[model samples]
Every structure is written in C-alpha cells, then in structure tokens.
Target chain A: MAKRTGQVRAITLKQVAEAAGVHASTVSRALNPATRSMVVPEVVDRVLAAANALGYRPNLLAAGLRTGRSHLIGALVPDIANTVFSPILSGASDRLASDGYSIVVADVGTNPARHLELANQLVARRIDGFILATVSRDDPVVDFCLDQHLPAVLVNRAEERRRISAVVSDDALGMQLAVDHLVELGHARIGHLAGPETISTGFLRRKGFYDALEVHGLPAGDYPCEAAAAYNREEGAKAARRLLDAAPGITAIVAANDLLALGAYDVAAERGLSVPGDLSIVGHNDMPLVDMVAPPLTTVRISHREIGRAAADLLLQQLTGGESSTRNVVLAPALIVRGSTAPPRAQSRLRNQQRGAG
Target chain B: MAKRTGQVRAITLKQVAEAAGVHASTVSRALNPATRSMVVPEVVDRVLAAANALGYRPNLLAAGLRTGRSHLIGALVPDIANTVFSPILSGASDRLASDGYSIVVADVGTNPARHLELANQLVARRIDGFILATVSRDDPVVDFCLDQHLPAVLVNRAEERRRISAVVSDDALGMQLAVDHLVELGHARIGHLAGPETISTGFLRRKGFYDALEVHGLPAGDYPCEAAAAYNREEGAKAARRLLDAAPGITAIVAANDLLALGAYDVAAERGLSVPGDLSIVGHNDMPLVDMVAPPLTTVRISHREIGRAAADLLLQQLTGGESSTRNVVLAPALIVRGSTAPPRAQSRLRNQQRGAG
Candidate 1:
C-alpha cells in the first residue's frame, strides 16, 4: 500500500524479485541505496532493467508500517489563501518532500474543527502523526491524539496541559522589539490592540505586551489594552479606535497582526490623522498585502516558513520512533522599520517647549 | 478496496442493517439518495443514527469493486489563486461531494507537468476518471491518458481532434457582445488583445472575433488583433501596446482576461490617458481582483461553476455505467458593462470637426 496524493500502487521488493527470477536478497542488494557493490554488475543491471519494465514502485507503506515510523506528518492551516500560511506551507512541504515524506494538508474552511476527523483519517491510514497549526489550548483534538500515544507536534500554538512538540516564534521578543523601537523614537504613551484570548498565540502575545510595559516602568493606566474577539481587519480597526479613544494621550500602537494594523490605518484616515505624525504604529505577520497598502507598515517580521519547517521536522522525528520528549523551538523575530513609525506629534514638542520656559 | 478519502474500510449494508436491527433492503433504501425516502421513516432513522454512531464508512472502492463504479475523480488546476478556476473547482467539489464522491485535487504548481506521475497515483488508487482544467490544446498528458484508457473530461479546452468530453463557454457570443458593444458606442476602429494561441480558448476566441466582425459588416483592417502569450497582467499590457502602436486610430480594445485589462490600465497610466475618455477597454473572466482594481473592468462573464458541475455530471454518468456517449456542453456567457468601457474617446466629434473645418 503506497499512499501518495495520486493513485499509484506500490510494488514490493519481494514481488519485483519474484518477477525478475532473482533471489530476494540479490534484488534487495541491487535496489538498496547503500549496498549494490557485492552483486555482479551485469546481474544488477539486468535486475534494474526488469524492475523498471515491471513498474515496480517502492512500497512505502510496508517499509514504514509501524507506529512512530510512518514518515507522514500533517500540517493543518486555517486558510491557504490568507498569504501568511503560503510561505509556511511551502517551506514545510519542500523540506518534507526532500525527506521522502508528504504533507496531508487539510484546510479548516474545507473541514471545520477538523482535528478529530483528520486524526481518524491519519490513524486509519497508519500515518505517523501530525503538525497542527490550528490548535486551541484546550482542544479536544490535541487531547484525543495525545491519548492514543500518537506522535504529534503543534505549530503556532503551545498546549497548556499537553506537553507535546512545538515550534513557535517568540512573540515576547516581537513585543520588546516593537516597544523598544517606539521608545527609541521618544514615544511615552503606547497602546496595544490585542487578539482573541481563546488561542495561545493571541493570549501569550497580549501577556508579553503587558509584561513589556511593566518592565519599561510606564504607567499601566496610561497605556490601554483593547482585546479583540479575533485577529482580523475589522476587529483590529475596532480595537484600535477603542484603544485610541480610551487612551487619548497614546502616541503609538502595537497591533496583533498586519491586517489589524491596516484596520488602524482606516481608523486614522477616518479621523484625518497622519500615521507616524499623529501616531506610530506596528503590526505583526507582515502579510504580502501590507507592503502595498500605501505607508508600508512598520512591523516585527517573523519567519512563518521556518516555524512551519521546524514543526514538520519535529513531527518527522517523532514519527521515526523517537520518544515523546516534549520540546519547544522558538524562532526570534526581527524589527522591520517601514514608514509607519516615527517621533510623537509636534503637540508633544510644544508641551516640552512650555516645560522648558517654565 | 477502501476509497472515500482518509477512510479505513468499506462498510456494508449488512452491517448497517444489523446495527439498525432492520432488514438489509430497508438499509439500502435509506442509503440510496433516489429511493432513500421509500424506506419506513423509523427504520430509515434507525439506520442513519446507527451508521453515524458506528462511523460506518462506505468504502467507495468496495462499492465500486463489484460494479466497477468507483466515483472518484482527480481534478488538476494550474493555479489556485487564479479567480477563473476557483469557482469551477468549488462547483465541481460541491457537485461531486453531494453524491458520496470526493475530488482528489492537485494544484499543479506543487508538481508542474507531472500529470503522468499524478495519473499513475490516481490509477494505483482506483480513480475512475479525471476532470482537468489545465489541459493544453496539444497536451502529452491527454495522449498518455487516452492510451491508458483512463476516463477523462476537459474544461475550458476542446481537443482539436474532438476525442474527449469537454465543457466550454460560448466564446463566439462573448466576442460578438464585445464587438457589438464597441460598434454601438460609435467606434469604427476596434482591436482585440487575444490570449495564447496554444490554448483552445485563445484560438477559438480570436476566431470568434473575426467571425463576429464579418457578420457585423466591419472591414478586417478596421479591427486589428495582437496575440498574448498568456492570460496575465503583463501580457495584456504588452499586447495592448502592440495594438495601440500598430493601429493608432483604434479606440476600443477587447482584452482576453481581467489581468490583461489591468495591464492595459498600466499602459493607459503610462501614456497619460484616462480610461473611457482616451481609450475604451473590455476584459474577460470578471475575476475577484479585477473589481478591486482602480477602475472596475467591463467584460463577458463565463459560468465557471456551471462548467465544473456539468463536467462532474458527465464523468459521474460514465462512472455509474449510465452511458459511453461523448458529450460537448457549451454554456452561454453574459456581458457586463462597468466603469472601463465607453464611446471611443470622442473620435467622431474630432472627425466631424476636421470635416467641418475643411
């Protein structure tokens, strides 16, 4: 049983050897990647010629039939077209493809709350395990997969109770980068447009922002934090407006995603306030659309692709009979300064001038 | 002989009947979409409830095994982001999914021109047939599949030799609509930006334009045509420039696709010309991104979803042993008038002034 995306059945070495009238061991030696040296050169040539003629496909299922050895790991993304998932999926797919592994991708839109269904599919087909990007902290899918002793890894999410393998970008480092960049430009009052608390990334990222604010010794009341129900354009804009209205003294904003940052831009344009002049803004994810959206948002650029690749690697390791040793690999985030961030407005300069005169 | 993606084994009607504690015939009636209602109401409920409880997966392969009617088909698309194929794919998926048949989709970018490899995969797994959206006019994959006797259907492409089932949009009606629209707008000199000749669409659409022009009693020289290498933005711009440069008197252009029309936008912008004021453009494929671009395009909209549904129906008929007859379904296209098209840039007014002065 050779399981690939297309419908090609695999031919076993035993079948190939029998068809070629060669000893199984001789056929094995001829086909082995490492040991074809001891066989007679002419015999090896003849065996290969016959094998090719017979269309003897490599029996992947028979080779990796055991648990922790199936060599197939899955990656579940919420959406394929949102651009943020594109590089991540491509990276994981490319890395795994070279290792003779295939990613069985299922989009959440096509299969809603797909973990249980996908898990059932993978388990029935003897797929080694999975790399889930769309995991909730208290997800039933995570609990079920872990309960079965299935080798699995989480991407972009860290399970609170289930200590499985994970590859996440340092959102704390990202927040620090955002805050430090703003401080360097002499902005005092800052606000954060946080994402939904249901997901781990959103919860942890918001916590990181508050922690950073405390570390900077800024007045907590001065910097308001508005929690959005989701990390999307409309939610971001709604959060940004509320954050701005609540914290009237705020000079900069830290958005949860690029889409959020764009939403903030809309709010600013509505109020007739210029970005970086009236407000300094920063966004995360740095999706492809943000670069073309006028001001080119200042943001923390994380390697979403590297995160996906690392997740696949961890899942593959687990699939290859490795012990269920819990591990979390965190990639660092880099601050990319575009046109969205700068010094606080001239109103602050006038206040400073008044203070100097006094 | 288990099929139905990601499933374990084929569940039988006996199992469903035994679990439901009902007659096998009753279970069969409940499962069959056509006769499902004929079963006793309580018996049907019991069978369905029991089947869901037991996860009674119908092995599409096992069902097809005895009857040789596996309702599995592979769909190949060149690009996913291209709006032209999105509706078609979605439509096919919907139509196939309703009949307990699931489509195995392969985005060609992941494995370009590896249709042989894909075909072999499908063949190994017992794919009954295929619906290919990316078939070229003279494709090798077509020849290979024909030789192997794999049931196949083409969408948007008609084989020049006409050996396979195909579903195409009426390019002649579309061309006539564009030509008549331009002529009614008082434009005597018009041109066409034709798509690649290698594709059946490109060839037929260009031919349709010639046929429509002759029927409309327009001189051949009055409407020149430039062939585009592909249905893309850059190609449209290049083709537009060539048409404009060759026939300076031409005021209206009929573009092969929306992306090409966008390219014409770039050309008009470069030449400091306003759309509808200096030049009139008509696009095709009314894709998602086209409406988002500055000036919404005027084009003929083809029903991609309908084409996909029709192809699925045709393939399903063959798989179910219903017929061996070849099918050719040509759907009609509708003309949309948006912001991009207008009376040909006051050419008649300018011409009238010239005559009056003389």
Candidate 2:
C-alpha cells in the first residue's frame, strides 16, 4: 500500500513521553483509561497533563487497518434541512474527526421506509460503526444492527426497548421546562403541540408535558393537546390552528419543537392575536434563528452539540475500547426566556382593570 | 479478489434490452453516452427512455472497483448550520447515491487553514472525488486538486479564475432582482449590507449590487454600503448599524444574504422603525423561516437544490464519462416579494401629507 501521508504529522506517543519524562510504552499505558490504574496514579496524571498541554491525539487509523476495519463511521440524519440535526452532526463529526475517523452522512427524507435498506448498504460497505439520528420508536434499522452485531449509537432519539447505546437530550425534562415556565406565568389552560408519536422526542415530550402539569397541581385534562404530523412550520401551524379552535379559552401553547412553535406564531397572526399578550408560546429545542423570529421565542435549549459529541464518544468506545456496555447519556435542558412568553391576557387584563378602578 | 456483492441488484442491461426490444450489446452501447452514436438514434432514444422510466441506476461501484476506486465522494461544508448548503448537499448526495456512491462529509470551521490538510486526509483514504462548498476566491484546495488531477466540483462558490467545474447561482442576476425590485418601489437612496470580501459569494454579490444600481440608472456611490465580516446574523447586525449610522436618510437596505437581512431587522427594531413603514429591506437566499419572521422578508430565491443536482451531474460526468470540461453552470434566481418591502417611507409620508392638505 502507498504511504498514507496527506495528513499533518500529529503529536506522537514519543513526544508525550519526552514531555512527561517517561518511556513511550509507559506513556501509552498511562494514557489508556483502562490500564491507567496499572501504573502509579501520579505518573498517569502527569502523562495525561502532558498529553493535554501538547494536544496529543491518538492515531486510530493505522491500528484499525490491521483488523480489516475501515476506521470510518456513518451518520444517518432524517432531514438535512432540519436545523436541529446540524449542531448534533457538527458535534459528532468534530469529535470523530479528532480521533482520525471520517463520517459518511446519509439523510433519509420523510418517507423512512428506505431507512433499513440504506443502513444495510452502508453496513455491507464495511463501515466500522454508525451514529443514527433517524431512529423511530421501533426501528427496523436498530433490529438489523442488533442482529448483525454492528456497533451503532443513537442520537437525539432512542428506541423504547433500549437495545443500543444512545446519547439524547432529556426530552421529558425539555418539555417540563417549557411547561413550568408557562405555568409560572399563570397560564393554567396551556395547550401542548406535540410532534409525531413515532419518534422518541415526540412521545417522551408529550408525556413529559402532562407529567409536568400534574406536578404543578394543574389538571392535564383541562389543557388541550394536539400533535403535529411533522416537525415543520406548516404542520405546526395546522396543529396550532386546530388546538386553538377546539380550546377557545387556552391562554398559552407549548410546542414540542421550535418549528412547531413557529407555526403557532402564524396561527396567532391569522387570528390577529398578539404574542405574549393574547397568547404565550414556549418552544422546545432552541434552534438557530428562533431567537430572531417576530416575538423572539421563549424555548427549552437542549445541548444538541454535546449530545452529538457524547454519541460519537460512545460509538468510539464500542469500536476501540473492547467495552460492550450499552450506555445511555442524557444531557440536561434549560429554559431560555426570550420575548415570546409572559403573563396570560386574562391576568394582565384584571390587573389593568383594578388599576383603572383605583 | 473476492466477488463484491454487498450492493443490491440494480436494473440490468438485459432488462433495458427487453424493455427497448434491442440486443444487449446495442443497449449497452446506447447507454454509454460516448458510444451511443454507434447505434441508431431511434434505438438509443428508446433505450434511454426505458432506463429512465424503470429507475435503472447503474452499479457504478462494481465498475469503479476495477480501477481501484472506493466509489466514495467527499463533501466539505463550511458551516453545517448555515441552512443554505443542506439543500445543495441533499441534492448532491441523492444524485450520487442513486449512482451507488456514498458521501463522506467534513465541516471546515472558521479557521480555513486546515482545509487542504483535511482534504489530503480524505484523498489519502481514496475518495474518488469531492464537492467543495468552502472554497475562497483563491483557495489552495483548488490548486491541490489541479495538481493531483483529482475529480472535484464547487457549489455555491467559484474560484476567481474559474479553474474548476462549479455550480453557482447567478449572483449578478440575483442582485439585479433585489435592486430592481427596490428601485421599482421608488427608493432613490438604497443601502447595501455586503458579506465578507474573501468569499466568492461576497465579492461577486457586492459587485453585482453596484452593477445592478448602474443598470437601474441609480448612482452607486450615493448609497451607503457596509460589508459584514461573516455571513451570520451578528455580523449582519453590526454592518447594518454602521450603514444606518452613516446614512440616516436611506429608506431601503439590500442585504447580500438572509442572515444579514435579519440583522437589518434588528437594527430597525432598535431604531423604533417599522418595516415597510419606515424602511424597506430585501435579502438574498430566501432560507427557511425567513417568511415566518415579522414582516416576512422579500428576498431573492436561489434554487439551491437544483444547483446541488447540477454540481453532482458535473462531478459524475467527470468521473464516469472521462470528460474534463471546466463548465460553470449558472442557474437563474427569482425575486420573492413579501411584507418586508414596500414604497419608501418618504414617498408614503408625502402621499399622506398631500391627502391631509387636500
């Protein structure tokens, strides 16, 4: 084989050893998390500190080729246009690239019937592993990966069975954040605009909303709930329109995703209702540019990039660490209060009326 | 070598021959564009039509391996979250995947120095070709591809010398659409929020703006212009602030891209000016959710998906047909009028004052 010499010469094990005043083999053992305890703790810490200071990254390509592995990973995203996946992909790709692996990306558009077929194609091509962002609640792709003993990690969404390793944002916690924010603003009759139930995000966030409302002493049955066919502004608007028409007294709406929340804004416009005045809206997944929308949406911000990095780490572990544990890392979600959420109109109206009478 | 049978059975030459009622050899000759003229046009047309109708995708992987190719392509996107490149990538990937090729993606972040280094890494891994969306006006990657005799295509950007095959929007025409729309709205004093000068889109779009002004019989230098350091909302807001500060009399602003136009919206909000009431704004690249923003943006719409498809076609031709024409396919752009643009506030104010006097 021709010499693979196109990449820049990365810092080597010998350099790290020289910096740490140790033998190269000793440095390697200390750097390996599993074998670090074999060496003295002080030497391991010194080696790790030296490696970090010098930006030493292990070259996994040469080592994997001997085992007939390509040292390449495949990432499957449902829709490339969906803003939520880009940050996750970026995070994952960046993490994997640092470890000398390149990601082959595939986007399975709305009709997910082709998901398994494409996964099989990539698997047949000898991809070392996969990081899937397109897994449905019960996915054939997941089942195929299990049957083949393929190393894969699910990101953003996970299967109900939990048969594979996954790194996902706390969907239940994200919805809880959205609901608590609206409830604190005195919105008792808040509606939930859920996403499609086939995806884990939609199912878990919907359940989370009801659970959160019950925790706050608000009856879940009092609030209207509607599910969007997809996570887009058009479907979101359609769902929002139906929910508002059905529950004329609902003062606020909690959207399962940012796109659906944008749809709610359109519905509010069509009805000539002012945002945060007549209708308060809280969106999940603080996607890029949502803060720049008309009312500057209040949203639950999930660390999508962190989730991507964590998923990449898990997949790398499965591939190189000889560790078979199926780990699920859940990142926390925070509430970002922008210009979209506020006190319900009824409360503000009563306060205004009292001031006028005074 | 082991017989590679990982790919599913695609439509065979026998199927096309059966559909076209021709000999297998004749069908093969007709399918190869270079050898099609050997067979009569009547038979060639029939075979081509049958191939299209039956969704007959050629198994390029099997043929490519004979020449020691991996049947893989590399796509380099500058920023994954930009929204502009997703459609392009989807188009390219869909086109390539149909031909039995997979795309390996890499994101070159703000620092572009590592572009060639990473490109070399993919090349060392034996990527058959590349579709680069991160090329600057004088990029080293272009020179590298030229030196190595590699198959590559540029999308949404081009080199200053046009040394490689590129699929770009008609930047000059897009600017013409924006400027003419504003000119027809009776705006004599229009400002421009330009993108970074280093990128081809920024450089060409800025030139297009001035050329468009000249065509509309408007003085170019009479209008204020500020260039953003990047194609992002924050830089756009900063540039918009400077332009507004420099020319308080300007009634309309033309942003080079949607993000910049969004920044102008921020400036308007800060100045207590209503869109189309105090200032009219026009943006290029009508990205998703721009229409959902307050005073939905009136902008130039580039067919990004079509551009992607065209780039893929060009790359495929170079790879299979052994053709190396340095073609630059420029697609036409359309102007989408929304609530963001209207007659200048000065004109509207004069009309209102006339009605009052009468």
DockQ leader: 2
Give a tens-digit lDDT track for model 1, residues A252-285.
Answer: 9998777778788878766666777778889997
Per-residue CA lDDT of model 2 for B1-358, tens digit only, reads 6322122334766898899999878987898887888999988999999988876654433333334467788888887756888778878888898987888888887677889878877775667888999847877888888766788899988766777899999999999998888889888899999999988898999999999899978775676899999888889999999998888778899999999999999888776677877789999999987887888899999978898889999999988887876899989999999999988765553454345456
Residue B176 C-alpha lDDT in model 2: 90
Worst 10 residues of 1 chain B by lDDT: B1-10
Q: TM-score winner among the candidates?
A: 2
Q: Rate the local accuracy (lDDT) of all candidates.
A: 0.72, 0.82
Question: How much is the lDDT of residue A169 in candidate 2?
Answer: 84
Choose the strongest candidate by lDDT: 2
C-alpha lDDT of candidate 2 relative to the true structure? 0.82
DockQ of each: 0.10, 0.21
Q: List the residue pairs that clash in candidate 2.
A: none
